[model samples]
Target: MQMLIIGGSGEMGQWFATFFKNEGYDVWISGRRGRSDVAEKLGVRFTSTPEEIIPECDVVIVSVPIDITPEIIRQTAPIMKPGSLLMDLTSIKKNPVDAMIGSAPEGVELLGTHPMFGPSIPSLQGQTFILTPVENRCEKWFPIMRELLERHGAHIEIITPQEHDHIVSIVQGLTHFAYITIGATLKELDFDVQGSRRFMSPVYEIMLDFVGRILGQNPWLYAQIQMQNPEIPNVHRSFIEQCERLSKLVVENNADNFCTVMKDASVHFGDTGAALHRSDKLINAKVAEFEELLQSIGKEKGLYHIYSGKTHVGIVEKVMARSVDILESGKLVNLKIENVRLLNSDELNAWKNDNLAAKTRDISTYIPENADPDTLCHILGKISEGISCKVHDTYISPDGRRSATFRIDIRQDIDINKIQDDIERLLEGIGCILR
Candidate 1:
């Protein structure tokens, strides 16, 4: 299958390019700018002239900014071949869906997809994917695409384009507006953000993180999200009106009215208990990680970097609120606690096996006449990631029993004696005698 992403130079587009590539598709990327370097990094072909490439592709995905999605779809959809699929990876749906349906040829399939996630998400697993398929336009390929996404662990919701945009007005519009407003308030008040963290509670800390997260992203994309959605202005108005009411209640010190407002809002919100439980779990997880770091002082621990996917094994020298100092290879490396995860023993061994070279040791042993050395070696290999086994040599023993030398390959930076002991126990259980 050949998949072409129209805006593949962008982060989200590059993400999908890699995604389709992993799914065994030949991915081609097209960008308005000279971003062949982006394609080179993703190991996919880049086309400066998407017009020539559009007709030949089996699937064409438009992944540009939301404001320009409809424009891109109009320009690209006409050149699409009959029976091919046209999709957009944007947050908003109605405008793009309308553009695609109107511009695409009679047989070209149209699907409006809103991947309810950011480019920072590694994979589709546990992520939400919104699909808005035209009534008669997607009968042929919709089921296959839906099943494919679901099989890869995505939660799919089938909705009309109108419904998707309507719901997203609250989901993205209100949430982002609230967080961005908090940031604006801080700036206007000249609040000391870093200094305040010293006296912050867990809820405040987590809320601050949410605010920073949105503030750190592409402002243009956020601007498009806030501006392009037709329903968002209404959301903004209601949000402001409530904010003013709350402010008035606070300034006037009307305790009874404030309580009444809060209580009414809580009732309307529904299911406060579940929200509390989930929040508590999040807070507890953070506390637990902090406790682990404190206890790991002076002990060797493996920390896995989130973005780089690299593991650093070292003795913990000191732990701070947001970072840790590790004594690795006689040098102190400071890693942000938020950017890394603590790797357990098994995870550390697995990382070692994948990232490090293996050291081989030959184990010569004798077994029963009916024993198969190849099977035994495979079993030994399965016992742990620290070691893998292969039959090196085979011969007949003095008592007519089978004899074999197993080549045990050990992952670097692991305990050799421990692996040897584990292999010994398995060999003994299978009735093999050491030479």
Candidate 2:
């Protein structure tokens, strides 16, 4: 059968077009802009004139914005063939379903559907498709639609239009309200969310991620879902009432009442233990995924501060099959990748500067003398003023000659040979030879 989707430039509409095309139907999409490139990518036909295409299509799905869907249904419903099917993809079903029933031709089938996902989802596996069949004059069309969705692993929930709206009010309305409120509160408080992450527990991090996810989507879509559903106001009122009751308990400092409230909620939810178990598995999976990302960062060639049970700073010289080779304080150290709890670039630049300073002081000289420690310290002190230097202990040779050694540390950007020559000239004047 030929299928046409209005507003097919939209993400959800494009999804439907592609899905129906994959099911061996001749799929075409009509939009205001006539996005031929999008139609080509989705392997469907594109048309700027939908009125010309509506009457020819066996299945017409109105997939426009929620607010515009009713009008689109009214315009196209009368033009559809007598035995053809009509449907809409609207989050709130009652209004669009009513419009289709009132406007569609006498014999055209009407089905209102809401696919509970976005376009980024790869397939319909384990996803839900809520169907509210308003009129099924073509009785076989409903079964065909159900079979097509089921073949692709979609779980179909057939309900009345009123029932769908009522359930979504709680499911989408209450949940999104809580998320949006939390996001706004954080913004109002000017919370330093990234700076305070060091103090966040896993649960807090997950909740923050969820808030981010919600705010990242198109605002109009969320607004439509919250505003278009007639049942949302009651849901919001109930949510606020519960919050007020919790606040009163806190104000009264009534621990017993709070416990009773918690018990009642737990009972209402039911299967608490199973829910906890499932959530624990999800949390563990997230933690493992985070660790794997850290391990991948550790395998990169750069300076990293590794923290397993202890902290060590080094440059990641090489990544081996079973371990990593790090150059730490002029020595190569190997560490197993799995043993690292955190490997970060926080102290990398500081460690690199220190390493460069150490490399500049690579030359060490010893001078043979029989001088007192005080005199040697004084001579070294004078030379130290010109450059960075540290004096070593004196050692007596077999010939009873005493020798002292010192090292010079300089900046990497300076002329190392010129500084060494200048220091040697001063040392020779003090009767100390470079050994």
User: In model 2, what is the error at residue 247, expressed in angstroms?
Assistant: 1.9
lDDT of 1 by residue, 123-167 (tens): 789999999998899998899899989998999999999999889
Task: Estimate the Cα RMSD of every predicted model relative to the unseen true structure.
Answer: 2.3, 19.6
- lDDT by candidate, in order shown: 0.91, 0.78
Error of 1 at 127 (Å): 0.5
lDDT of 2 by residue, 185-212 (tens): 8999999977766687778777887898
TM-score of each: 0.93, 0.67
Top candidate when judged by lDDT against the true structure:
1
Model 2 residue runs over 4 Å out of place are 135-138, 292-435
Cα lDDT of candidate 2 equals 0.78
Evaluated with TM-score, which candidate comes out highest? Answer: 1
